[model samples]
Target: MSALFPTYKRFNLSVKQASGTTVEDTDGNTYLDFGAGIGVCNLGHRHPDVQLALENQLNQYWHVSNLYQQPIQEATAKWLIENSTGDQVFFCNSGTEANESAIKLARKATGKHKIISFKQSFHGRTFGSMAATGQEKIHTGFGPMLESFHYVPFNDRDAVKRAVDGDTAAIMMEMIQGEGGIHMADPDFVQEVAHVCRQNDVLLIIDEVQTGIGRTGKPFAYQHYDISPDIITSAKGLGGGVPIGAMMAKKTLRDAFGPGSHAATFGGNPLAMAAAQAVLKHVFQDDFLHGVTEKGRYLQERLNKSVGDLPVVSSIRGKGLMIGIECTEDVSHKISSLIDKGLLVLNAGPNVIRLLPPLIVSKQEIDVAVQLLSGVLTDEKASIT
Candidate 1:
């Protein structure tokens, strides 16, 4: 009897309000939030700085034509560029749109039609970005997909080498396959892919949609490696809860995207830009990211010690604050159990329980989440016998 489409498998709990890694249900029950709105609220729900920035913008202006002088948008773009090798940016409404723009930029800049992406990698849901996604299930009914998108095994440099050719426009990839089960790409493999693309005049597009904006203890996860991508697509945590996405490319490709080639009506609206400016100002600091890295290391160690040997747990892997716990059986029930027990978590693929806590989560919070997860997993192990 719901008016909404059946696109998502909705959760039972009604989110009435949320703040700083905590959510209150309609019935007044509170839960510690570990999912962070699928990594969109990295600074935690309605962070003070972001809230203040948005409020100030609200008192000024909310929307305007892209043709007008938008200094806020330019400032937000400068923040992204300051933390990346990219020099130019095209703003959009979401990660999908950012990725869609990346696809277009890659093809137009290189004058190539085919694209190389990794199997199990996820880009977005839009046509161009969805086509770039290598998962078959996502493309099940959307055929005939925009053609010439070749897929290869992730982390297999040999597969990538065999797949790239003259017609390849770009090789799109994720640092930690966020939606594809929290798989981490090897650093050497990433560097090699960048090398291959450079050698062939193919652009290297890094999709940092899920892992950017301080999600992985850095501005973007690609910063963990030595490779420099030709383009970077980002969103998710970029606006710290507001809707915003940006596709940044090297200055060399600026001509390809000339004013008329691409755009988004509400791409860098004042509200979104204001929110991003606050988020970037706080998260781009060295102390903040260092805290994330340390907390990530601590969380990994604690999880390994607590649940690594559990009968239901197959493995625990990932980097920074993005960790995944693979189980021997389906984790859907366990996830529900955790939700019922007052902890909000999410799944990556079928069997992996992905943990993406707010970057502002403290060590005490980490311990609490681990204990809750450990208890549920222990019970899951007992039921599997």
Candidate 2:
């Protein structure tokens, strides 16, 4: 009976409000949010700083075309470049657009038609991005996907070597495969990939949409690998809850995207820029990133100690707050039961329970979430027995 498209199999809860690490459903039920809006609200729901920035920007101006000079956009881009390996940036509205931009830029810069992406990698849903995504399930109905994209097995250095050819423009991958069951890329594999790209004169594009903006205990997850990517795509937590995405590139590739080469109407709008500026200002701090690293370690340790012995649990993996608990069976029922227990979670695939708590979540909240999760797993085990 709903007017909305049946795209998502939504939960029964109607969240009316949220703050920090909690959400209140219309029926007045409060749940500890471990999903953090699927890694989009890393600073937490309606963070005061981001909210204030939005309010101030609203009082000033919301939308402006790319024809004019926008100070806020410039400042946000500067912050992003200053904090990461990129020297220039292209602003967009979502991860898909950012990736789309990166793909086009790579092709233009190298004048190569083929792009090499890893299997189990997810770039985005747009035409170019969808083609870049390695999962066949996502491409099932979309026949005749865009051409010139080749997929190599993830974390397989030799396969990557085999996949790259003279026509290859770029090699794209996620530092941690969020949609692919929270799989972390092996450090050696990543280093080899960077080396391969360099040898082939192919650009290295890292999709940080799900793992960027402090989700992985670093300003950008690629920083952990110590490899320099020619381009990086980011979104998710960039604007806190507001929509914003960016495609950052090294100075060498910046000229490829001439003024008319790529553009987004609302890409660097004042509102999103304001929100992003606020988020960057807070998240780029040494203390903030250090806290994320500490919290990530804490969460992983707690999960290992509390549920490691559970018959249903296979492993707990990931970096920073983006942790996943691989279950022996589908976690749908367990997720639902946890929801009933006032805790919210997400699934990386069918069997992995993905937890993306906000960067600001307290240790107390983590303990509560873990305790609730333990209870749910225990009850499910009991039912099975």
Candidate 3:
């Protein structure tokens, strides 16, 4: 009787309420939320600041069709650009839409059609982004995907060099490949990519949809690498819970699109803007981001200790709260075991257990997650024999 499509593997739990780092199911069981709504709830569920901002905006207006210039939209864009260290922003409704806008702007800017994307990288679910996404599974049914998009292995400087030609419009990449098993791009590899882009006069578009908004300890993952992307796409953590997406570009690429070139109906609504403004203001504090670094280290160290002796856990990867644990066994079963034990975790692919705890989550909560995961993995190993 469900009206929704059968595309997603549905979870059985009926979540009724969520607060801080825990979600209460309709059956009245509370579960620790380490997934953080796939990185969207970066500030945790129903944060006071975000809640208050939305409440005030809700009383005022919800949607305005992007005709009259909204002040909140201007404030949000200014906040994002100031934090982003870029020239401008193109607002959208989701990560895929933001990426689509970025790709289109890149192509239009360079006056070329081909885009160079990397293997195992995920851009988005839209046709343009789907074609830009390196994984094949996302493109199975979408017949005749956008042509002129090419993929190369990640971290391969020479392969990227080979892929870029005059017809190539831009090179798109994610700093920490989210769905591609939480792999961090090598710093040297990033520098070389930037060099290639500069030499070829091609744009460098970074997909920060998962790695932005202080998820990776810094305001952005690229900040850690000290590399500048000509254009950047962001979404997941920006709204603190509300839906919002944006594409930021340096001055050159910012001027690519003229007035009528692109648009989104709900791109920068007042309510979403208010929520985003709160997120940027709260997370941009030097003290909060510093705490993120400390908490990230604490969590990672604890996980290393708990899962160290197990042969099944191949590696722990990623930065800050955007961590991934690569297990030797199937990740889905492990995720289910963790969920059964009152800890909510997510599987990035077949073997990577992705953890995107809310930035406000404390060491105490992290300890609970680590202990629960340790117990589940231990029981799983014992049962295997």
Candidate 4:
């Protein structure tokens, strides 16, 4: 009997060990990992730098409550601020908490209540974040959602313009809808949203939980766009596999979140901070992100060549390492076929196959992924040999 809740559609394979882009099942089966723990393991499993940092921090005092004023937290926060528009940051244990914090802070800071989010956009699972999410299915069993959130179609400039009014506190969205089928926000649409926010005194919050921390070949996916967000919520790839989340905002709104306003017990654990510091070092490097961009182009090109014209495929989208292959039909069986062929990938929804390989994954590994996709779509044998 399983003690866990019947929540996730648990995969048959049990991961016993993982390294680089490879995962070994409990029964001694090996698979090339392309999901990267659903885009959390951006540096791949147990990256040497991140692993060493965690090990050293583990030897040190691992968990100290926020009262002690940890300098490691300052160091990590500075990295985020330096690379983005945020002047201050708050840490938490997961994306949900970070976003929840953002919602609270935005309303408190602006002294307004209503928030505008986009349809098909996912923020998180908490009540506040859930209320902000545009998908109706996520709110089905949760009973009446928290009030004062409005949803508009993604990339629809006029809907966003119409949604924002004097009562609206902020506008929250994702640069790429990672959970909503890997849809990228149009650059022009982003500019228009920012303009609307500026004119209406509305805070623009970008949820980077799945698209931040170099997931989109940039420090944050919003960096690719022309405008910057008033606040940013980040996680997933932040700690290189460790659980950590952050909500960053400009200095103008700093006073709103006065002491005792918001807090997380495990927010800045020494070990998670250590992991984040190590991750930031590599991600902020001169050519590290450039490499990811190159690899993304290569991966997309290969996918286009291999299965772009297949009858089952509809389109290939997303940027950086966060590519999605949209199919005309359900892709559950195709994903199972890839897993059987020793290539581990995941589905974004029912019909979109999402690929999020670790930034460190090489062209050869990408080739293996393409071969698996090709073989499965073509119904042929896919062999590493």
Candidate 3 lDDT, 282-347, residue by residue in tens: 998889999999999999999999986787788998899989999887888888878888998888
Off by over 4 Å in 1: none
lDDT of 1: 0.93
Ranking by lDDT: 2, 1, 4, 3
For model 3 the TM-score comes to 0.98
Q: Per model, how many backbone clashes are there? A: 0, 0, 0, 0
The lDDT per prediction is 0.93, 0.93, 0.90, 0.92
Residues 1-385 of candidate 2: C-alpha lDDT, one tens digit per residue: 9999998999999989999899999999999999989899999999999999999999998886899998888899999999889999899999999999999999999999999998888998989999999999989997899999999898999999998889999999999999999999999999999999989899999999999999888999999999988999999999998889999999998789987898898888799999999999999999999999999999999999999899889999999999999999999988999999999999988999999999999999999999999999888778888
Model 4 misplaced regions, further than 4 Å? 380-385
Off by over 4 Å in 3: none
Worst 10 residues of 4 by lDDT: 376-385
Candidate 2 vs candidate 4: the lDDT winner is 2
Residue 9, model 3: lDDT of 94
What digit string (tens of lDDT, one per residue) describes model 1 on residues 1-385?
Answer: 9999999998999989999999999999999998999999999998999999999999999898798999998898999999998999998889999999999998898899999999999999999889889899999986688998999999999999999888999999999999999999998999899999989999999999999988778889999998788999999899998999999999999999997899889989889999999999999999999999999999999999999999889899988899999998788999999999999999998999999999999999999999999999988878778
The true-versus-predicted C-alpha distance at residue 349 of model 4, in Å, is 1.5
Residue 2's lDDT within candidate 3 is 87
- Supply candidate 3's per-residue lDDT for 316: 90
Candidate with better TM-score, 1 vs 4? 1
Give the clashing pairs for model 4.
none
